[model samples]
Target: MKFPIAALLLCLAVSGASAEATYGAPPSGLADHLARLKRAYPDVILDYDKTKLTLKSGATIPISDGRRDKSFDELLDEPDIDDMFAFPYPAHAKPAAPAFNADPGRVRVESLFREIYGDCRQGAAALKMRRVPWFGGSVLITTRQGVDKALEAVSRDLEKLPKAMQKYLAPSAGTFNCRAIAGTTRLSTHAYGASIDLNTDFANYWRWSKAGKDRKVTWTNRIPAEIVDVFERHGFIWGGRWYHFDTMHFEYRPELLAR
Candidate 1:
């Protein structure tokens, strides 16, 4: 069967770009994907400059030029349309990581998320919350922007797995919290209630790895593909995919998954 024109273009784009990070390269089928999105939500596309993603409904999302280190807040809040691919999500599973730093969905500018998901510290914002039974037990999470629905989809799907596979999920480490990332004032995805962490025991974080002579941290992950696949299908990105890996974390961000 023939793939969509966009999918073909995307494959070409990915092939042309270095394979280190999934989102590091420009989206090959971006034009096609955008066309599809326009068809699905005509109201969202208004007009466009060469690099701007304009919505007819009055929102303009910019595309990054793939040049510099945008701050976490900048990437999350004012990211260029291109920045959406900062981390590469697995288009199809292969045995290895995409390539060095091929993290297409990793970028997030704080203000952007705060605009859509709301701040968790403000009790009123995260109030529109609900619970999903995680591995047969309940856990509270934000319902903003259909996040609750997405996570529920994840839960329902995970429930079908064999009982042994299910054991790693239960006793979930956590779901919604107002906290800064370790050692950084920058707010975490958790602060938006869009993230979740699984059992700590089976997880591996880059920080836990030994530092080099230069003191830079090395990346590593132990989370199984079986688990990552389940989360990705439901709009969650795996922390295990990061160069600075945090194997236990997952968060909802479909814009990153548009590829």
Candidate 2:
């Protein structure tokens, strides 16, 4: 006996649909995830216009349609709402490996930051900078865009941590340098004073991982979750979460945590 042609087609269709549902779509709770982030860090999200995210400080960033990297100038000029979530957060209750193309906080357009924070290299603007005491000593950082207040908040919370944890933060790594990324002309978060790296000994850098060409990076983390939770609660995201991990660093990109 032979099966009917239509029945076979229907079976194939169902199988294809199941496969798509299993692997093609992202997790369904993006809205809920954003809500959790909002609850954790209130007032961080200024505006959520369709594809544009305007921060409370009146800086607007354009979210891309998930295609390409926006230039520093382009990112600064007009960032969309989607751009805010370019960096990914933990999607499950337990820490699972990140999905392919799971880089959530990776999307940044440099100009958007340079506009609000001022170009640090110019020297004309960065002169208005101030210092925040990270552990015991202080580190000079930019004051533009309420960043000083945010870092102060971060410091206050970090100070409450146990002494062992605090040691990883001091003898600071420096901040507010007007320099491009290590290898590229693109500006780094360090250039804006929006980023900080903890003690070098306690951190991890992707370049340090040497596998063969096209070698898979092994994700290793020693920084306590307690430290990361504190930073995220204050609207900072950990570099440890990135595929290209920088375990001892955190940056102030509240828009990414904004709902």
Candidate 3:
């Protein structure tokens, strides 16, 4: 069957499972993803075409590197803008067991983020930080794309939950840290100030668990659905949803939740 590119991309964007296999190829299904990026960061993304994405700052990034055989590690470490949508974010859906390597929103394009949020290594990302009230205290988040406001909204909705849920939230593990993902040199979303880690006491990380001969870490989640729901409602994608789960983490990535 044949489907127009626009309609097909829209389906991929809103569907619970992303069109990971279909959209990863360069210039193949780029339009819809680009549209979502524009919508997700309307103030920043200027325009896009089959080959490149242009930002408000007049910087252009190749939509894809034209490599179709990138290993998962390569996808994570050297992704192009198109690879960012390689996995679909199941926003508002019940938390289910992620398929092996189904870590959506983890394959980030470093250059694109550095362009959008500024490079942390150069102290550029820090310059964009603004404090947003969380629980009783405050956390520093990027003011760009109104992420600070989004976190504020998440806080307002979280406060409406019962008091018992408070323990998993207050004293956030941290936010706006200028560092790379533990072992990798790639800048973490944290370095961009667009992510927040909730209370680590209730957190469960894949790395903390010892995998058996099959090398699969058992999926465990301590954070309640009620809490996860609020963050997604405000454009945050939870790390708990990843196969490499980190239940306490959530990052702003609305492009992955265009529905």
Expressed as tens digits, the lDDT of each residue in 1-259 for candidate 2 is 3668889999997775444312112234545544543444344346454355456667656544453445433433344434445445752123334553344565555655566567767774653678777676788776665667878888888778898887678766777677876756777788778778888878777668774544457677777777777777776777777766777778876645643
State in Å the error of residue 94, model 1: 4.0
Cα RMSD, each candidate = 11.8, 9.6, 10.3
Candidates' TM-scores?
Answer: 0.72, 0.68, 0.87
Q: Residue by residue across 1-259, what tens digits does model 1's lDDT show? A: 4579889999987675543222224556666544543443333355555576665446666655575544444454445555665554663363254454455556665544665667777873554778877876787787776778888898888778777776567678898888888866767888777888988878787678887754456666666677778778877878877666787888886654543
Q: Count the backbone clashes (under 3 Å) in each candidate.
A: 36, 21, 0
Ranking by TM-score: 3, 1, 2
Local distance difference test values of all predictions, in order: 0.66, 0.62, 0.84
Better of 2 and 3 by lDDT: 3
**Deviation in Å, model 2, residue 80 alpha carbon:** 6.9
Which parts of model 1 are misplaced by more than 4 Å?
1-81, 95-98, 124-127, 213-219
- Candidate 2 has an lDDT of 0.62
**Candidate 3 or 1, higher lDDT:** 3
RMSD of 1: 11.8
